[model samples]
Target: MILRIAMIGFGNVGQEFASMLLARREWLLKDRGLDAEVLAIYTKSRGALLSKRALDLGKCLELVRGGRNLSEYGPESTSLSPVELISKCNADVLIELSPLNIESGQPAIDHIVAGIENGMDVVTANKGPVAFAYKRLRNLARSKGIHFRFEGTVMDGTPIFNLVEKTLQGCEVLGLEGILNSTSNYVLTEMTSGKTVEQAVRAAQKGGFAEADPSLDLEGWDAAAKITALANVLMDADTTPKSVDRQGIGGIEAKDIERASSLNKKYKLIARAEAAGEGIRLSVRPEMIGPDSTFWSVDGTSSALTIRTDLMGDLTILETNPRVTQTAYAVFSDILSVLESIRAGTAH
Candidate 1:
């Protein structure tokens, strides 16, 4: 079965995913017996290009790398929005790789909703929808009998969600705590080495670990969004980034880092969500952890999530120096999972 995919964003992760898909095309066909094709590529800057036939992935990559519009590839470009593309595109899966709008979860959420309503499976790396409207989107997907997977929303491609869903069955997740934001972790790690916050953040930006506007990472909103998504999925709680008690590392000075280091502790921007009295407690804050803690040794752009379960004790998953490819691999993983579900007649 050829899985026709309509990608709704042509940003960094989107381009990487497209490249990886093309690079692994033969392997995907010969080994997994899964024939996948990108049918359309849409971007806010370049407009939308749709082909009923399989799109030329190499050409798409070339056009994107050359800073040329996707519309130049022979398909008549439509000024249609992402929601319009999702509604009208003849594709099996709608891959939402757009930039996150933490405030409203827009455009990405709208795209996913339209995709599911229009009878297409949905996959996304955008954390906005899951952080702000998980239950609504999730229930809509179930009602429409489609798949909605966002494995890249959390720890990039570290398989946090997959671990909870595929493994750890019959065990209850009591709590989860870890470093979810790589940019913050990277900055903090650099700061511990005598670098100032601005200097460390500059390094992160230069390395593509931090965005141009680092407010999301420095202000703790990114980690909050991630933990909110985790809580909604694993704990069955409805929460948003605004609801999480967040404290960023932006205010931490060099002296603070020095103090923590002298005290034999490291400051990490930790995102924690756990079962509270009658509800789930979520927080993203910079906490000083000692050497004995699982997250204390997690340095650089690495991320670690420790899940405390009733039966399995504490299981910690660490992802070291995650880049755009890791996140793109998460989307690819979701695509394969969707294919497997289709083959097994369990896509819903």
Candidate 2:
């Protein structure tokens, strides 16, 4: 069967996926009987519609390279809202790479619901809706018998979710911890080297590790969102982002990092959610990990998740880069795996 695909939010990550589909067009068609193409793209910005073919890459890339949006490159194409596009598009799969709207999960939620309701499989990089309303969405997918993939959400391009679902099947996980936000990690590492939060944050921004408005990362909400999603997938519960107790690294002064360093410790943003005696207690913030700890070595924007379980104690550690890759192989890999599992009549 052909894997006809459409992408929402044509940003850095979405573009990455588009390039991947183009590069691997022939390979997927040949090897897996999947013919993937970016059938449609949606964005809130009206300027995003200024381009060609409604699916042109050269023009889209030119816009991105110029720090302009697709709308600036446009001439002719239907302009519709994201939800409407999902309902109307003739795509077998809907790929969601929109920015997280923490309040309502907005356009992401709207797009996901529309896609699945219209009998389309979905792959997402957005964490807001998943962290907030996973059970509802998954149940919706279950009822529709459509695939929903979100590997890039928890950790960029990471196998953490799949590792839990596949490698650690039936494993009773006791606790979860990770450097889930790359921007925070990079900033904290710089702070540990004597840079101020302001300074480190600037460096991260210059390095493209942070957004122009980086409050989500500075506030710990980003990692919190991912951790909450993990809790739902690893355990179970459609918990909201507000449900997690959050503490970002913003309050962390350079002195804190210095003091930790002097004490043979490193400051890292550690996100943890545990199956406590009463219930699940979740937290995300900067913590002082000892020099010898695994987290201490996780410098830069790379993220690592450590899963502690009843059977194997600390069983597996998974890592993923902070940035979306040049291609969408990571996301495609997730889709392929999910498809293979269904073909085998297995749970993923």
Candidate 3:
């Protein structure tokens, strides 16, 4: 089978995914009997590319790496918007790798809707769509008889959603707690080693994981979004990030970390969603834990989640320090799963 792909964003994760796809081309064909090709790549400012035949992903990576616009690819480049590409590209899969719009899940949601409306399977690593509009988009996909999957919305490529959906059948997710934001967790981990919050944040920024304005991570909004996404998917909470009772590490001083260390404890930014009556309650806050805590050693860019399920008791999954490759793998694995569903005639 040949799967044509239309990607809505060509940022870091998207670039890494394309590189992986190129590297695994032969293996995919020989091992899985599948040929995956990128038909279109749409970017916000850099430009877009579309072609009936498979576009050269290697050249696309080269141009992006060389700091050149995709339009420099000559005639293959087009001036079409993302929606137009989704309508015209005739791709089998729509990969949404767009940056997170925490305020409101815009253009990403718009692009995904266009893909589903155009009879394409959808895969996204953006947490915004799941956190903001999971039910509606999911229903739309079901109505259109397309597959919709997002395994990268939380914990990079750890397969949180897939774990619950595919592996743990008949189990009910009662609540969840996790160290969701890499920046926040890394900053707190650095503080444990005697670095101040500001210095730790600077180090995170230099390390390329934290944004220039790290407020979203430091202020707990990132964790809020992750928890909201998790609850919306696993527990059917149907909520957004704004509904989180949030508190940031901004109020934490050096003395706080020092005090925690003195008492054999560490501060971690924890995001939690618990079943509350017919609704779910969500919160993100800085809390101190002792050596006995599961999150005690999850430092740097590492993340961990503990899922409370009725049948399986408590299950915790941990991912060590992750790079863009993990997130890229999330998209890749999701695409493969979509293809599997397609082959099995269970996509709907």
Candidate 4:
């Protein structure tokens, strides 16, 4: 069975995912017995392209590298929004890689809904929809009998969600604490070395870890969104970034960093969500952790999550250095999961 895929965004993560798919095509077909094709691609600035036939990914890469739009490709090209493409494209899966809008989960939320309603499985790297509307989308997918997976929402393709779902079976998740934002973590690590917050943020931006407008990362909105996503999925609660109490690293001073160092501790931006009575309590704050703490050793652009469970006790997962490729790999892993479910005759 050929799984036709429609990509909703053409940015850095999208480009990396497409390239990895092409590079691993033969291996996927031969070892995994899975065949897939890219049917359509829709970009914000580059227009859209759709075809009933399989799209030439190599040609798509060429077009992207040359700084050309999809409209310049062929007759099938047209300037359609992501919603239009999702409604019209004859694809088995919809890959949503668009920019996240936590304020109002637009375009991405609408696109995912359209795909599920049209009888297609949805995979997304965007966190807005999951953070704001997980229960609604999950219920919609359940009623439609399709899978909705967002493995890249939290830790740039870390297996947090999958580990909870697949590995931690029969164990109840009581609570979770994590360093969810790489940009903020990088800034704090740099600050510990005597660099000012501005210098650290600039270094992060140059390293491609922080965005040009990093208000979300610096103001704790990014980590808040991630923790909200985690709470919705693991704790089965509905929450948003605004609902999560947030505190960023911008307020940390050189004296504060030095004080932590003097006490043999490190300041880290930690996002925590725990089961409180019937609801979940969430907060993102800068905390000084001692050497014995699981997060104290996590430095640089790395992330760590410690899940408190009933049967399994405390489980800590760490990603030493996560990058774009790891996030792309997360998307790829989700696709393979969809395919495996179908192969097992479980996918609806």
Candidate 1: C-alpha lDDT: 0.89
| Candidate 2: Cα lDDT at 42 | 70
Which rank order by lDDT, best down to worst?
3, 4, 1, 2
TM-score winner between 2 and 4, please give it. 4
lDDT of 3 at 106: 78
- Give the distance in Å from residue 192's predicted Cα in candidate 4 to where it truly belongs: 1.3
Off by over 4 Å in 2: 46-76, 316-321, 341-348
The TM-score of candidate 2 is 0.90
lDDT for predicted candidate 4 compared with the true structure: 0.90
Deviation of model 2 at 118, angstroms = 0.1
TM-score of each: 0.98, 0.90, 0.98, 0.98
Query: Where's the lowest-lDDT run of ten residues in candidate 4?
Result: 339-348
Candidate 1, residues 1-348: lDDT per residue as tens digits? 688899999889999999999889999999998788888789888657877788888888888889998888885467777787777778999999999998989978888888998889999999999999999999999988899999999888789888988898888988989999999999999998888888988998899779899999999999999999998988888988999999999889999989998999999999999888999999999999998988878999999999989999999999988888988999999999888887888854
Global CA lDDT of candidate 3, please? Answer: 0.93
On TM-score, the candidate that comes out on top is 3
Residue-by-residue lDDT tens digits, candidate 3, 1-348: 999999999999999999999999999999999999899999988889999999999899999999999999879899998999999999999999899999987789999999999999999999999999999999999998899999988988898999999999999999999999999999888887889988999999999999999999999999999999999989998889999999989998889999999999999999999977878999999999998998988999999999999999999999998888998999999999998998899964
Total clashing pairs for each candidate:
0, 8, 0, 0
